[model samples]
Target chain A: MSGVRVILDQDKCVGSGQCVMTAPEVFDQRDEDGIAVLLTTAPDTGQTDVVREAAALCPALAITVRE
Target chain B: MTSDTVPAFPMARAAGCPFDPPPELHRLQDEAPLSRVRLWDGSTPWLVTRYAEQRSLLADPRLSADVTRPGYPFPAPGRPTGAQKLGFILMDDPEHARLRRMVTAPFAIKRVEALRPAVQKIVDDLIDDLLAGPKPVDLVEAFALPVPSLVICALLGVPYADHDLFQGHSRNLISRSVPADQRGASFRALHDYLDRLLAQKTADPGDDLLSQLVTRVQAGELERSDAAGIGVLLLVAGHETTANMIALGTLALLEHPDQLALLRDGDDPKLVAGAVEELLRYLNITHTGRRRVALDDIEIAGVTIRAGDGLILANDIGNRDPGTFTDPGTLDLTRDARRHVAFGFGVHQCLGQPLARLELQVVYSTLYRRIPTLRRAAALADIPFKHDGAVYGVYELPVTW
Candidate 1:
């Protein structure tokens, strides 16, 4: 199976870090602003589940994960 | 124990255990995850106490936070007249989300993290003042209330010099026992004051949140009334909850010397973060349950909650649910307590949480490290707990080194 691609709208991101907290491997926060940055837009198979969960739980609805 | 009558909601905590929830709340969680509880209005609402039930139900679109909705549980005695014109905290979906999103940027993790140095300076200056002042200082006045109050004032572009005006009125506004007219009067005063500030910011914008909203208003992105509504909400919510948590959390740590010792010596950021989460879970300062009304029939835990049914989600009980947390009552800093619903859940979950967390992190770490000998000046029994208030905390936490 192919990996999932994560897209983050930085402007809308409230920097809750829910995405980074949920899938550390796929997402990391910028040091200066705490906005979400895609560590890996295409997360590998094992990380796909959590990457999706992070997108779903984001309060600002800033993250989008597409196959 | 099948009886036609239900236990009253807002049950009192067990005698002498000031930190824990009412024994009856735990009992209900044990016997039935979902059960009915009578409110002050003599109406019975379903009280959901378990973590799973609370999380799901809070997230359910079938449930609404709109105070105007039929059967919406009004936790406190006051009717909160003209609540529809107030902030979105009491509104549902589109309106709530719209207003909430406008203010999210300021409290975003990065933004709050950036304020860490300013927050640290605030904490440090307050501690210096406390140390130099008379022994047995009231931590609430000296530290807890001032830090968040100043921070929120700065964030909203309000002058800290006007603390006496808003802080006093905020106390009345949130007090569960204050007369309805008094609370309403206080709310109106604060609302009018903020509305005036919003109008001023429109003419002369500063570099604060109010200025940002003013810019938005000028750009035709937001209404002046909505901006003022948000200002009122942020001013109240920003200071009060975090202030209570600071006072209560410190007292909780003081009670548990073992945890305090770790926080005092342990320089691990991860450990400090975990300790904050544990304290948030254990204290659960929002003692009154989160209120809602079911918009549609929803089945959970083998019972169906019908449409128009009032529901009170007891966050204190769920935070202490043994099913979700290990040895939930005991304050274990090492426990994975991040999942606790101390901030409530779903869309209405506290928007100021990021800033609150940052402030707590700085205060807990710095206070213990600077004054290693900090101890209670007065005995725990002598301290007055806010049992009658909407928020759970000590009125005055006297402390000395």
Candidate 2:
């Protein structure tokens, strides 16, 4: 669980911004459309739990986290 | 389930406990998380009462938000079911996403955060008006309704002077007991009003949302009718939902003095933010469940839902689900209640949530603190609760300082 990778499916994203709210360090929404943009594909150990929570909270199921 | 066994949809909340969801909803969640409930039309839609199931099903592509769909459960009889009437909220994605995205930038978290100072100013000015005005003022009129209405008016480019036209019609639109023709008339009134306003914005574009919508229309990215519809949605929802939350949240806080003390005495922004989420969770203003229809067969909790089956995600009780929140009945401001689905769960979840949150955070943080002696001017029983409306709140909250 040391190295965590996050993938956001832009196609499935509905721009709910739950991921951005939940894990600001790992996700940021594009200014133009509010679609989520991954700040880091690989989140550090401290950010892993919140990244997982963001993935769980994403309404569109657009965020995927692999550890 | 047999008709005799099926409980009617939109069950009434217990007497004297206006803040709680219908007791039957809690029982259903405890006993059968997914069960059938009879609607006004004698149609039984599956009522998903549990939090996890609701979030899962709401996110499922198999469910469609199109109001015109055959099995879609209308809140009441005689209500119009036009998907265009409320804009993209009643439509599913590709289309929902397309129309919703056009206006998304304005309500994005960052954009809404920028609105905090303006909202705070509005709250402060309203509280000033309340303090200066006669004692025992109707908070709904003197404070609650005006806050969101003024903010939305500025944001949507709708004139605050025309508040009566929009507010009156919106009142008719959300009341479940309103006659169908009256409701239809109200819908048209707001629709036509917004249409005319959009036309005005087309001629003299302003630095607001409707004007931005006009820009999309000129670029051929959005239809004029659709732009009007989006205006109607934003106008009605932006004001009605948040206004009710302010009044209702204030009432809830007044009843719980300790909670009020925590909010009124605390200087921490995090404490205020948590209180807002807890209030949103505890007092789910949208009590009439989120209505939807199944687009494809789905199986959940050992129940097989047919493609045409209608579904109601009762997020009020879902927020109260014991599995999700411990001691769900209590209103603890300190509780980590952010996970609650008061605004709902899924792509079609509240688009105005950021704005709503910002407004509530400002009000909850500032109001009680500013007016430390704020109390109910009328007895709780004398207060008119909006039990018949699609949104739950007080019609008028009389308050004194």
Candidate 3:
């Protein structure tokens, strides 16, 4: 396990889906409004790099990751 | 504040290098990353030239994209600002978020990925028409414009036959040199057209974007005028930006046969996707920098931007910042150019980017391979570039196989 804690601030998310596009395994968008929904709060070791990438790529600065 | 010290905004590109950004922007990036530049109205806004500063400032909540605010730099003297005409995209948060969310589902990554096959079909059908058409056809008119126009029409349920009505007005809307009254008239025309179309969708709805908006309106979730405004924004932005990228990307690729051959002969999907990103980073269709005004006093990079100060986030030069990308001037297709701000950044980052990427990927992957001998029929100097328009692209690309 990566022991990575990911927090998504829905209020701040613009729903651009940069996170979902960057790390699909760890994130997805709500079907109703396209707001991001986390698929997993703690990503595996293999998914850590891409999860961090999703956090960085997010335009709204909505994603926060604690390693 | 002297004219000699402060260079004017929208600086001209080099005479021979139509693909590169204005040379002055490069110098500004090197000497002073954030410096003042005069707009058409004699207002000096801070022009952000470096990539790092652009991304951070664009994402800063203190910088407002709302054009209605005072000191918001207008690209031209009397041109109608986007906030005056377009909805959501030009507004600030809360209100911007409310309107933007109502139509976000259709353009979500999953939703757009599902549209890949359909987008592929659109590209394939257009290429078929191009192959059958006469030699030396204007690719801009024949292929580039129609591909996105057709796809957007199908998505929005706007009849493609009405393209002439919308496209003509769209041209007027984006042109900086167009008279203010003429541009206002174009805005009204498109707004009224979409307004009526929304009414029709209400009477007989379909499984398309406008109908979706109609549903929101009926449920008391959105206003009719705002719905129409969103329609106009999506319709105009959907086609215009992509069409330019298509024609200009083709021109760029043809100019570099080595890069063109890499895309043409290679079948790897990753290579094709990387090529699309590189082209977007290089061409930067939105040539006029992203405009904003500081809502609160902010300090960064050893400078204080007072409230009401205007800013021009020059993404064209920012994309070419050597600090971010290696050998930024060279058009290398294989480089990891994903961080480029060609699409702009922050909450206002392009909503339709997934769709844009899907369309470009399909076209870049399929076009060159299908038409191996696709070469430019016109000389570089003879081709007309879109210097007058807000977007940067060639006006017409004449090509022959």
Q: Quick one: best DockQ, which candidate?
A: 3
Docking class of 3: high
* Interface C-alpha root-mean-square deviation, candidates in order: 4.6, 1.2, 0.8
Q: Where does candidate 1 chain A have its weakest 10-residue lDDT segment?
A: A27-36
lDDT of 1 at B53: 90
lDDT of 1 by residue, B1-401 (tens): 23347888889998889999999998899998899988888888899999989988987878998888779888777766554245888888776766666776777555677899999999999999988889888999999999999999999999999999999998988888888889888888888888899888878889899988888788897887778878888999899999999999988889898999999998998898888889999999999989999999998999999999999999999999999898999999988787878888777778788888889999999999999998898988899999988788989999999
Candidate 1 CAPRI category: acceptable
**Stretch of 10 with least lDDT, candidate 1 chain B:** B77-86
TM-score per prediction, in order, is 0.92, 0.98, 0.98
B243-338 in candidate 2: lDDT tens per residue? 999999999999999999999998898988889999999999999989999999999998999999999999999999999899999999999898
lDDT of 1 at B296: 92
In model 2, state the lDDT of residue B146. Answer: 91
Q: Higher-TM-score candidate among 1 and 2?
A: 2
Count backbone overlaps in model 3: 0
lDDT tens readout by residue for model 3, B313-400 = 9999999999999999999999988888998999899998888998999999999999999999999999999998988888899999
Off by over 4 Å in 2: B79-84
lDDT of 1 at B158: 99
lDDT of each candidate versus the true structure: 0.86, 0.90, 0.91
